[model samples]
Structure formats: structure tokens, C-alpha cells
Target: MFFFQGLTMGLAYVAPIGMQNLFVIHSALSHSLRRAIMTAFIVIFFDISLSLSCFYGIGTLLDHVTWLQAVILGVGTLLVLYIAYGMIRDIPAPISLKDQPASLRQTMSKACIVTWMNPQAILDGTMLLGAFRVTLPAAESTPFLTGVLLASGLWFLSLTGFVAAFRHAMTPRILRAINVLCGTVLMLYGLHLGYTFVQFFQI
Candidate 1:
């Protein structure tokens, strides 16, 4: 039960405009296959660790410091704003890599930076998921995290693989449509986050 719930929740949380999905999709089409798989693994590593931290560390912190929720909310809100700017400015699409992925050390370095720098992902994977996991009976949390890890890995890997199969179909028109949709959702979600922040802060 915990595993199933975790799998469903993880899929719901991860399928959106987060960095992991973007990297996988981009790499599958444009970067080396091995590099793309490595990126997905890096993302999964972060997700699992973040969830564990939330499970153990954040749960304890929040029990005492009610303001922790606000901090997470603020971080999430800010990320949405930053991404909104990028979308609204119609920033030129990233240049797709024509070269093979970097060596293992270089890939690891880049993956670390990308995984760590994404504030929204950090909050969702560690902070929110952690709190929820802590609420579960201790017997189930391990399986819960296992389910989440599997979901995260599968989502990214399958996303990249499926998109790669259609590499030629990712025309400019398609990319533009995706950008428009992503930008719209980012702005809407940011506004929602701001509203939630205000509502929770006042309580």
C-alpha cells in the first residue's frame, strides 16, 4: 500500500516541468545515451536522499519550528518566479548537444550542480515527501521510499527513451508548443504558491 501510494505520488510530483524530466528528454534526443541514463540516475539519487532527509531531519525540525513550512514554500515560490522569467522572455531554447556526453567525472560534476541548484525539486523531493513519509508507520517508510525511487527512475528513463524514439518529431513547432504550455503552468503555479504562502503565514 505504501509502495503503491508512493509510486503514484512520485509520478504525479515528478512528471511536470522539473529539471530532471527536462534533462532526460533533452539528452535522449541530443546527448549520448549513456550520458542521458547517468543524468537520470543522478536525479534519482537526489530524490531518494532528499526524501530520506525529509523523513528523518525535516520531520524533527518542523515539529519544533513551525516556520519550516514557510521556508519551503518560499523556496518553491522563488523557483517558479525565476523559471517564469525565462519562459516569458521567450529565452532562446537551449542549444542541444551534438557531442557525446562528458566523461564520468565531468558528468557527475554537472549532474550534481543541476540536481542541487533546482530549488523546486529540492523542496518537493525532500521537504514535502519527507514530511509525508514521516507520517507513515515506521514499517512502511522504507518500502515507500523504495517505491518513490523506482518511480523517479522509471519516469525519467522512460521519458527519455520514449522521446528519443520520436527525436525527428521534435520539430520547432512542437518545441514552441511545449514551451508555451510549460511557461503558462509555471506562472500559474507560482501564483498559487504565493497565495498558499500568504494563507499559511497568516495562520
Candidate 2:
């Protein structure tokens, strides 16, 4: 039950695809598989820590901050829009690897930097995902965390393998498709975020 529950929720969280998956695929196909895994581990580390932190800390504190919901919604807006822009801008860079060798340490460091420091990940991991756990029974709370961590691991591993297997398929045209998909999702998410913000402020 935990496995399937984790699998379903994990896919829901990651199904749309995102920047982290993009980089992992890019690295695995062109650079070192070791490097992709290295980076993925870092992402998972931060993701787990953040999930736990939000579950324990932010979820509780948020109730007291009357204005926090609005503030968070606004930040989420900028985040999604900015990611949309980045998806458009960086799509071209995926193929031009500079032939740089993937360094395990470098990949790990980069993933950690992005996941831990990025406001978007923090918001999603804690404010959003963690908040979902607040209403669950105590026995099932463990499953929720399990689901999150399992999702992260599965996403990274599959992403790495997919890219490695289909490196040749990811041509420029395919990248264009990926860019369109990523950009569209980011924009839609941005719109949802804005709507959420407006709902909170009622203006």
C-alpha cells in the first residue's frame, strides 16, 4: 500500500516535469551517468530535509502569520513565471554541452544549491506539499513522507536512464518540443498561482 500510494502521489508531484529533471536528463545523456546520479542525490537530500522541515515547522507557523498566505502566493507567482522564462531561454543550451565532463562533486553541489536555496522548491516542498499532510491521521503521515522521498528517487533515476537510453532521440526538434511543454506548464502554473493569490487577497 505504501509503495503504490507513494508511486501515485510521486508521479502526481513530478508528472509535469521540471528543471531538475531537465538537467538530470541532459547530464545523463551527454555527460556522466555518475554525475547525474550525483546531482540527483543532492536534490533528494535537500528535498527530504525541506519536506521534513516544512512538515514540522512551517506548517505549524503558517497558521499564525495571517498575511503569510498572500505573501507566499505572490512569491509563487514570480517563481512560476520566472521558470517559464527560463524554460524558454535555456531550451537551446541543452544540446551544447561544451563537452564538459560531468564531475560528481560538481553535480552534487549544483543540485544542492538549486534545491535548498531556490525559493520555489522550498515553497513547494514545505508550504504546499507539507501543508497537505496537516490533515492526515498520524499513522498515515509516515506514508506521506515516504511518498515524497520515493517520488524524488524514482524521478531522478528514471530521468537519468531515459536520457541515457534516448540520447540520440533528444535532437534539436525534440528539445523544441520539450521547451514548449516545459514553458506551457510553467506558465499555467504561474496563472494558477496568481489566481490563488488573488483569491487570498480578494482584490
Candidate 3:
């Protein structure tokens, strides 16, 4: 029962079109199949790590430390906006199987940044997963967390696979359009974060 519950919640949590999802989608649409898969795995690693930290205690620390939250929000807002600007400025060209891919180190660094530096993700994970953790029976914690982690893995793999399967049909125009749309969404999210930060001070 706990496993299923956790699985459902996990799916709901990750299904939103957020920074992590946008990065995965861009990687799938732009990179080779193998590279895309590797990127997905890298994202999954950071994502799971963040979730674990949130569930364990990082969220509690953030919740109690107003200054820490402010710093994260301030920095995250700038980082997100900068990334969005880059995505918009450097819209990827059409698929070229012969194109050289980015290095694994760069990809891993980006994955880490998108997952770890997003204040919204941290707060949401803390409020949702961390709060839920306190409600679980000690014995059921393992299975429930297992289910949540499994959902994350399955979702990213499935998302990457689906995008890769249809990648051949994606034209340069279409790719550009998607990139612009994602960047716009990211920009809006960054503004929202800025607003939240300002509101935090007002309170």
C-alpha cells in the first residue's frame, strides 16, 4: 500500500514540466541516442540525490533558516535566468548524427546544476517528500522511498526514449520552436522565483 502510494505521488511530483524535464527533453532532442540516455542517467542521479537529501533532513534545515532560504532563492533566480538566456540564444540546429557531442563532464555538471541549484525544486521536494516522510511508519519508509526513486528512474528513461524515437522527424524549425518555448517557460519561472524572493522579504 505504501509503495503504491509513494509511486503515485512520485509520478505526480516529477511529471510537471520543470527545469529538470526541460533539460532532459533538450538533451534528447539535440544529442545522439546514447548521449541522451547518458544525460538522462546523470539527471536521475542528481534528482535522486536531491530527493534523498530532502527526505532525510535538508528541507528541515532550509525551512528553519530564513537567511539560507534567501541566499538560495537569490542565487537560484539568477542562475535560472542565465541558463534560460543561453538556451534562447543558442537554439540547436537540426539533428546531425555526425555532430560531435558535448563532453560527459559538461553534461554531468549541467545535470547537477539544474537539479541542485533550483530553489523551487528543493522547496517543493522538502515540503512534499520531507513532510510525507514524517507521516510514514518507520518500517514502511524503505519500500515507500524505493517506490519514489523507481518512479523517477522510470519517468526519465521513458521521457528520453519517447523523444529519441521521434527525433528523426524533428526539423530545425521545430527544434528551434521548442527551444524558444522552453526558454520562455524557464524565463517565466525565473521571474516567479524572483518574485517569491522579494515576497519573502516582504513577509
Candidate 4:
């Protein structure tokens, strides 16, 4: 039951085509298969780290801190809007393998930033995992967390695999359409978050 619960929750959190998913998809389509896999792994690492931090105690602390939440929401709203703007402006061209691609260090840094800076991801960890962790004993937490880790690893691997498989068949027009869709979604979500942030001040 714990395994399945963790798996379901993990899928629920990751199913959205948010910034992390889009970044992973872009990496898979435009880079070497190995590079794409590395990026996915880096994201998974961040997910695990953040989830564990929340499960341990940080989530509870965050819940009590209204100012911190406001700050996070404000910063997240801005960052997401910036990302949305970038996505809309930078149209995808026909992807080509470059002789000199991004270094592993650079790719890893980007993966870390996307995963960590994502406001939605942070909230999900603090609220969801934090709540769930309270329902289990310490011994059970490990197994539940293991299940979560498995789900994260599996999901990213499958995502990268699917994107890599179909990348060659995808035309530039299709890629551009996808970019537009992702940007629109991010913009809408950012607006929604901004509204939610405003609600925090209601007396």
C-alpha cells in the first residue's frame, strides 16, 4: 500500500508538463541520448533531495511561515514568467548535433536550477510529502521514500526514452507548437500563482 501510494503521488506530481519536464524533453530531443539521461538523473536527484528534506521536518517549518511562503510565491511567479517569456521568444529551429555541445557541468547546473527553482515542485514537496510523512512511522518512511525514488527514476527514464525515440520524426513545426503550448501553460500558471499570493494578505 505504501509503495503504491508513493508511486501514485509521485506520478501525480510529475505528470504535469512543467518546466522540469519541458527541459528534460528538450534535452532528449536536442542532445545526445547519454546527455539526456544524465539530465533526467540530475532532476531525479533534486526531487529526492527536496522530498526528503520536506519529509524530515522542513515542510512543517515552512507551513508555519507565512512570510516565507509569500516570498517564495512572489519569487516563483517572477521566475516562471521570465521562463515563459524566454520560451515564447526562442523558437525552435531544426535541431542539429553540435560538434561542441554543452559540457556536463553546464547541463547538470541547468538541471539542478530547473528542478530546485521550480515553485510548483517545491510546494508539492513541502505540502504533499510533508503531509504524507506524518501518517507513517519512521521505519515505514524509508520504504515509502524508496518507492517515491523508484517512481521518480522510472518516470524520467521513460520520458527521456519516449522523447528520444520520437525526436527524429518530429518536425520543427511540431517542436515550435509544443514550445508555444508549454509557454502558454507556464504563463497561465504563473498568473494563477500570482493571484494566490495576493490572497495571503486577505484579512
Candidate 5:
């Protein structure tokens, strides 16, 4: 039951369009199948690692440290802005299959940064997962964690396949519009996070 519960929570959280999804879709649309798979795996790695850390009580430590929270918020906002800029200014032409500018190592690094630097991701792991973790029996914890990991991994794989399946139908115009939309949303999200951080300071 715990495993199923965790799986459900993971799917619910991951189904929404977010930075990780955006990158995965972009990779699927612009790169080879192998590269897209690699991106998905990289994202899953970060998701699981973060979840595990939070489950082990790291989230509680973070909550007690205002300066660390502020620093994370600041850095996350900046990274979101940077990613939004890339979305707006650096979108490549729609390609069915093309060589990506960065190698696998660079792609993996960017995936890690994007996954780790997003404040939402951190909060999701530390707060949401941590809360759920507290309610579970120690013996069930492993199953629950495995469920979370599986859910995230499956979602990424499905997302990659979904984007890849439709890659041929995406025209340059459509792709450009998608990029613009993603950038606008990301920029707004960053601004909101920044505002929240400032509000905390004011309080």
C-alpha cells in the first residue's frame, strides 16, 4: 500500500510540465533516441538521489537554516532565468534527427544542474516526500522509495517516447511557439520564487 501510495504521489508530481520535462522534451525533439534516453536516465538519477536524501532527514536540517534556504532560493532563481534565456534565445531549428551541440557529458551535467537547482524540485523532495516518509514503517520505506524511483523513471521514459513520436509533426513555427511559451512560464516562475524569497526576508 505504501509502495502504491508513493507511486501515485510521484506520478502526480511529475505529470505536470516543468523544467525537467522541458529539457527532456527538447532533447527528444532535437537529438537522437540514445541521447534522449540518456537525458531521461540522468533526470531519474537526480530525482531518486534527492528523494533519498530528503527521506533520510536532510530536509529537516535545511528547514532550520535560513541562510542556506536563501542561498538556494537565490541560486535557483538565477538558474531558472538562465534556462529561460536559453529557451528564448537558443532554440535550435526543429530537427528530426540532428547532432546536439553538447556532448553526452555536457548534456548530463546540464540535466543535473537543471534538476538540482530548481527550488521546486528541492521542496518537492524535502517537504512532500519527507512528510510522506515520516508516516511509513521502516520496513516499508524501501518499497516506497523504490516506487517513487520507478514512477519517476517510467514517467521520463514515457515522456521521451511521447515527444519522439511526435517529433516529425512539429514544424519550426510550432517548435518556436513552444519554446516561447516555455520561456515565458519559466521566467514568471523564477520571478515568483524571487518574490517569495524577498517576502521571507521582509517577514
Candidate 6:
């Protein structure tokens, strides 16, 4: 019961279209199947690590530390906006299996940045997973967390698989359009973060 509860909650938590999802979608639409899967695995690694950290206690630190929150919000907003700008400026070509993909190291670094540097992700994880951890039975904590981690793996793999399945249909025009839309969404999110950062000072 606890595991299912966690699984449902985890799916709901990660289902939103955020930077992580955007990265995965871009990978799926552009890269070869193997590369896309690799990207998803890399993202899953960071996401699970983040979830573990939040469940253990980092969330509490962020929750209480106003200065740390401010710093993260400030930096994250800039980083997100910069990434969005790059995505818009450099739209990818249509999918090609023969195309050389980005290095694994580069993919790992990007995955780490998107998952770790995201202030909204950290706060949300802390508020949801970290806070909920306190309510779990000591023994059930492991199972609950297992379910959450599994959700991350499943969702990313499923998303990658779904996009890869339709890779052939992704024309250059379609890919460019997707890039623009994702970039616009990211820009909006960055602006929202900036607004939140300012509001933090007002509070």
C-alpha cells in the first residue's frame, strides 16, 4: 500500500513538463535510440540521487536557509534562461541514426545540471518527498522510496521509448517547432523563477 501510494505520488510529481522532461524529449526527438536511452539513464541517475537527498534531509536545510534559497533561485534563473536561449538559437536537425551524438560526459554534465541546479525541483521534492518521509513507518520508508525511484526510471524510459518510436516522422520543421516551443516554455519558467525570487525578498 505504501509503495503504491509512493508510486502514484511520484508519477504525479514528475509528470509535469519541466526542464528535465524537455531535455529528455529533445534527446529523444534528435538522437539515435541508443543515445536517447543513454541520456534518459543519465537523467534518471541524477533524479534518483536528488530524490534520495531530499528524502534524507537536504530539503529541510533549504527550507530553513533563506540565503541559500535566494542564491539557488538567483543562479537557477540565470542558468535556465541561458539554456533556453541556447536551445532557441541552436535548433537541431531531423533525426539521423548515422549522426554522431554528444559525448557521454557532456550528457552526464547536462543531466546533472538540469536535475541538481533546479531550485524549483529541489524545493518541490523537499516539500513533497522530504516532508512525507517523516510520516512513513521506519520499515516502509525503504519501500516507499524504492517505488519513487522506480517511477523515475519508468517514466523516463517510457518517454524516451515513445518518442524514439516515432522518430522517423520527426521532420526538420517539426523538430524546429518543438525546439521553439520548449524554449519558450523554459523562458517562461525562468521568468517565473525570477519573479519568485523577487517575491522572496518581499516576504
lDDT scores in order: 0.65, 0.64, 0.88, 0.77, 0.81, 0.88
Clash pairs for candidate 6: none
Off by over 4 Å in 4: 99-114
TM-score of each: 0.64, 0.64, 0.94, 0.85, 0.92, 0.94
For each predicted model, how many residue pairs clash, with residues at least 3 apart or on different chains? 0, 0, 0, 0, 0, 0
Q: In terms of TM-score, which candidate is stronger, 5 or 6?
A: 6
Candidates by lDDT, descending order: 3, 6, 5, 4, 1, 2
- 151-174 per-residue lDDT for model 1 (tens digits): 878887888778766765576556
User: Where in model 3 is the C-alpha error above 4 Å?
Assistant: none
Residues 1-203 of candidate 2 have per-residue lDDT tens digits of 65466557666765556556655654565555565566667776766676677767665565688687677667667765775676566544454434545466666654654454344555665665666676667787787778777887887777777776676557776766767676677677678768877877774
Worst 10 residues of 6 by lDDT: 91-100
Instruction: Put down candidate 3 lDDT per residue, 1-203, tens digits, no spaces.
Output: 99988888889999999999999998998898899999999999999999899889897688688799899888888888987887788767768885456889988877887898788899889888988899999999988998899889999999999998998898888899888888889899889989999998999
lDDT string for model 6 (40-67, tens) is: 9999999999999989999768768879
Residue 141 lDDT, candidate 5, scale 0-100:
90
28-106 per-residue lDDT for model 5 (tens digits): 8777788888888988888777778877877777779878888878888887888788888765676756566468777
RMSD of each predicted structure? 5.0, 4.9, 1.4, 2.5, 1.6, 1.4
Task: Give the number of the best model, judged by lDDT.
Answer: 3
Residue lDDT tens for model 4, 26-71: 7787677878888889888887887787767775666788688788
For candidate 5, give the lDDT of residue 87.
82
Ranking by TM-score: 3, 6, 5, 4, 1, 2
Question: Which is the winner by lDDT between candidate 2 and candidate 4?
Answer: 4
What C-alpha lDDT, on a 0 to 100 scale, does residue 60 get in candidate 2? 59
Model 5 global lDDT (CA atoms, 0 to 1): 0.81
CA displacement after TM-score superposition, residue 95 of candidate 1 (Å): 8.1
